[model samples]
Target: MAAVVRGMFALEPAQHRAESCQPGGRGDASGGETQPVESGEIPRCLLVGPKGSGKTALLFQYGLSLVRQGRRVTFISHETLHTMPLHVAGATKPDPLSLKQLQILYLNTQEALLKFLSSIHTQAPLPTQAPLPTAILVDDLDYYVSTAQTAESAPVVARLCAYLVDAAYFISNKLSEDKTSVAGRILCPVVATVAPPGDRTALQWYERFLTSVWEVKGVAGQPTMYQLSDASSAERAPLVVTYEIGGTLRVLDVQDLNEPMEGDD
Candidate 1:
């Protein structure tokens, strides 16, 4: 089963607690402080963009970052798996999963994805050992949505979104169990990428559930640009993120860009 599933499970001692304890990190708050404003709250972020807009790359990069931060990451992608061989061929040494800690799930259909989630929910408890913090990265959510739309047995978009949300919540609950348990102490955030909506209204469905939304635009001979804002805010200017060829993601605040440059003055 492991051979066919591409599973890698390595239990490593907690290395950096500070990295996991940060506000946006995997150790997000579990209880008390506040409802939605808790310091350690897990985030549900959605990234929307056209083809070749670097959405998949950004998702993978985020997964790599989480792995580096000593967090367990489950990177699920149907599209990425189609090109996995090429990616593995060109992969650099000490690759992202070389540590054997990340759980990479290649799901091609909605049923498969749901089944995986269901298994996680019902799986037997882990031994009394500290589990690494966890996060989920789903690449190309639009593909799944489209797949469901074309299927005869698929549910409506709203129902599909609810299923996904339930899966995410189930995973989070499993990870955020009693601290002494093996699955306890883990924070699980769900981050996914979707193709830009053909009809703007398509976005309304995702926005209803996602905590944050980011839009990526790519232009020939220019850096890929990203605009990030809260899901509820329609009027707020997006915080821009520029992706450069050398793998640098420069975040530029729109307010800062609006200020007159010293040379311009």
Candidate 2:
């Protein structure tokens, strides 16, 4: 059976990506919406920002590149997804070429992620050639996590993240074990594009639960954007040198060259 995956991001949570909370509250990596890990370095990332922050656009560009490289990629987004030529054909349902190109899942319902993952896992394989390396992309993640009223939904979301972390570990270490399994050796890194929490409540929650966090702060006067660096950093990490879909670019972390901040908000 082909590997199945629950999407990490969906469009429903776009509105509530950033929410404020009281000073003392329970949120962060350990107890909140997090992406934990099993071990080893996996190429998983979380792109966070509010609506119109260009998350979906960036994903489309990235997905296309992976397709060109012969990587089996999947994109999960809700907005203007039909615009992506590689995802769909003339009408609804993915075309054979599109399916073989990369598995792109666009959804209107937030809960559809589970169903989608199930479908991927259980689907019949193509007889043409070897299966491509899979890269799962989730476009918007904050909507469901923020609106989850009961413990039920929260766990569902968390469990999905845990699954991703597990999948990454399994893929990275697939051949390392004494008894290698055919399953683990074929997977690729799972990349998710999430809207980072803009306010106290969301930010705290993300820091606690997510294994990796990368921030994008709009540059003051410059046309290009940059990434925030940890306090110990000696220089700017690097500017976004590569361009992706809808003109999205890589993160540039240039703390060392930039002026010091009076205080962070």
Candidate 3:
């Protein structure tokens, strides 16, 4: 999922697999598992785009990529598409068995989503099994946050972000502190897709808690052409990724896209 646009956002979900190997790292004597708060876990990400700009497809691809690498992912959505076309960066077809590693949880309401997130924190301390998941992927976060009764209230958005951040921290630190990781330190990142609010003010409210942001915009003339912009960094201009969405996210050379970006929503 992250393999194609990863270059755009520089999201390396694979880092969680190698955190223990970092220099000067200390872990259990057997595996040198990364210690709590010691490993540099991948940052949680927010993929923002208008409808049909390929945000959900890209997310599914990213999670598939992580699963292919022997990592586990928990995908949550209030309304997952019944027929979402999915494939990894270079795969000819999405593997059927890989879906096992990608656990899909249908959280169908705003309250359900919040309660599920809160439950992750309150769950019994890190289990004595495999390490924590590599990533938590949420689709259509705007629906979850904006459909609440108090959607316009600041606390609505604030609490959601807080819950997500805490989950990332808990998955990263609590599991490692318990020395339950087989691959050293535990690293978990949360990635979610959101439809950009029509009002820029509302969009800004959501970004306040985002560690990374990638926006997908469509080409005006070419239906297959989409430009992905990495706005995660304020220090530099957002890097743009123009690509054609097929079975895979095939990158189109920058010189080929002569059309201006417009709406696909």
Candidate 4:
């Protein structure tokens, strides 16, 4: 049932669109009664890496896995990943959300993006029901930089950034106040794909925006992945691992790795 293939690095099935993933069924808020927690555990995760570092793939695979379990997942991709055929299709008919009359907004411009985010803050809830649990998956945070480049666009970009940070803060606060509320129940795992900046200002920009950063080095042939836990280490000795795919993506079973072997020709 676990569709995680070794070295595949894709999002879980549940995170993908509803057309392909349907495992845990659906979340019917109006069902009148709530179901008891069978697993007693919430499955949530966060992924951060560089561009083309398999971040999106991993996001999809893992998201799909959660979807198969009947979890409500929201995939927020930037201009690049959101435009991809698979992603666009998934957004059109996202796994459980589409069935639940939920909306998945894919913003291509800074203005539309800000408007969407602002609504989240202004929207109030009904008295009898709890706010819906929202699992947010944001992809390619680097886009924020590009969107901020234009002088006229900087305000919107800044607002969007503030919104994201605020969303995280709001969710954290909800989780603290009520253990079983939507804000509390929501699992937001963001995936950002960033590249090494061209200059000091850019580097500073990246450092200010990202809370955590990881590295994806080498190339398709001789690839290496590293999670830079220490800020200082990111510039010095970042964690690096090389991998190749043949069959499935089962991270736990990835063996036979000796050294940074020369890639195939």
Number of the top candidate by lDDT?
A: 3
Stretches of model 4 off by over 4 angstroms after superposition: 1-51, 65-71, 79-104, 125-133, 149-159, 175-189, 219-241, 245-265
lDDT of 4 by residue, 159-256 (tens): 55556555544543343244354322233333334455455454444444333444444344444332222232134222233433223222322222
lDDT of 3 at 48: 87
Q: Whole-model Cα lDDT per candidate?
A: 0.53, 0.42, 0.64, 0.41
lDDT of 3 by residue, 1-265 (tens): 2323552322443334333432112234355445455333446678888776667777887777567656678888787668854443544345678888888889988788888778777665434543355578889888777688863645777788778777777766765566434545555667888887677677666667765677778889988778876665444233456778666566664421224566733
Candidate numbers, best TM-score first, in rank order: 3, 1, 2, 4
Candidate 1 achieves a global lDDT of: 0.53
lDDT of 4 at 167: 55
Q: How many residue pairs clash in each candidate?
A: 2, 17, 6, 32
Which candidate ranks first by TM-score, i.e. highest?
3
TM-score on alpha carbons, each prediction: 0.66, 0.53, 0.76, 0.52
Flag the better candidate by TM-score, 3 or 4: 3
Q: What is the lDDT, from 0 to 100, of the residue 246 in candidate 1?
A: 30
**Which ten-residue region of model 1 has the weakest summed lDDT?**
1-10
- Quote the positional error of residue 229 for candidate 3 in Å: 1.2
Worst 10 residues of 4 by lDDT: 1-10
In model 3, which runs have C-alpha deviations exceeding 4 angstroms? 1-4, 7-34, 38-42, 125-132, 151-153, 236-238, 246-249, 254-265
Q: Which candidate, 2 or 3, has the higher lDDT?
A: 3
**Candidate 3 lDDT score relative to the true structure:** 0.64
